[model samples]
Target: MSHRTVNFKGNPVPLEGPELKPGDTAPNFRLQQNAADGLGDATLDDFAGKTLLISVVPSLDTSVCAQQTRTFNQKAAQLPDNVAVLTVSMDLPFAQARFCGTEHIDRIKVLSDHRTADFGRAYGLLIAEGPLQRILARAVFVVGPDRKIKYVEYVPEITQEPNYDAALAAVA
Candidate 1:
């Protein structure tokens, strides 16, 4: 079946099956992030040689986004130390940091896409047209230590949560 097309905020976007698979090389991505230390930038290489749980959320301020991040953070704590849980969102770095602080979230790393929506666009998470214009849809991708996509979950609703169990199992 063909994937869905939707606009987020205002940008046009297409949701497509990943071009890279579990055995295929995961695509490289550079992202802006908010850390406890401060604003920083990261790339796919940063998570190389380790399992990666990439939880893509629309915005950290939203209810679904908050729940998604919380769930991932909880799960990340249970995973091996070498595994990294990275939550990517379109929220500003400052906003992300505030959300983490408000929620007392520490297990997962929150990455921002405010400077450039490159990671969202590259992963086909950016919605094309909608009230959430420029924001991403809820999606999850699990990458193995070798940087291959081991699992993928793209929520049908813009406000729904991804299948945490399946995504987590892929990492396990």
Candidate 2:
């Protein structure tokens, strides 16, 4: 574990992995997507060869997280089919599905890391302590078609939103 730190509000907290940067290979992950019958599996390989905008949030219930997901949903809907948008969080698949239905989040895929914090640990966004322990840090990653990171933004404060323009531009 890299155990890097990032500020949450005014407090500093440890994270579980290295702070990723552009040109790095995007880490592989196994996450869950909601299905009508039950939770379905999703993996990094499922998105192979597509440009991806991964919006990471601590939870969708928070205001900033909701707004961040909604912002990306709208932005991504206008993008080409080869570009895909995903929002990963600690929320369960059922909760994520409920949020998507309530928020009209059809343009993007809202995934769950609650089963296992694989995405968080892999991306270095897993909060390691304090009130938010086990939750993912607020961040954004743009993975190019080659599965290399094209952009990375770790929001300095967990309550804040990421740079929408910069991430969207990375996809363009």
Q: Tell me the TM-score of each prediction against the true structure.
A: 0.86, 0.96
* Candidate 1 residue spans exceeding 4 A from truth: 1-3, 6-22, 35-37
Model 1 per-residue lDDT tens digits across residues 1-172 = 3255644444435554343345666678878876658778999988768988999898888888899999888888789988999999988888888899999899888888777777776777765453556787788888888777888777766656788889888888
Error of 1 at 154 (Å): 0.9
List per-prediction Cα lDDT, in the order shown: 0.78, 0.91
Give the distance in Å from residue 125's predicted Cα in candidate 1 to where it truly belongs: 0.9
Candidate 1 TM-score, true structure as reference: 0.86
* TM-score for candidate 2, residues paired by index: 0.96
Shift in Å, residue 100, candidate 1: 0.3
lDDT of the structure predicted as candidate 2: 0.91
Q: Model 1 — which ten-residue stretch has the worst lDDT? A: 11-20
Q: For model 2, what is the error of residue 101's alpha carbon versus the real structure, in angstroms, after optimal superposition?
A: 0.8
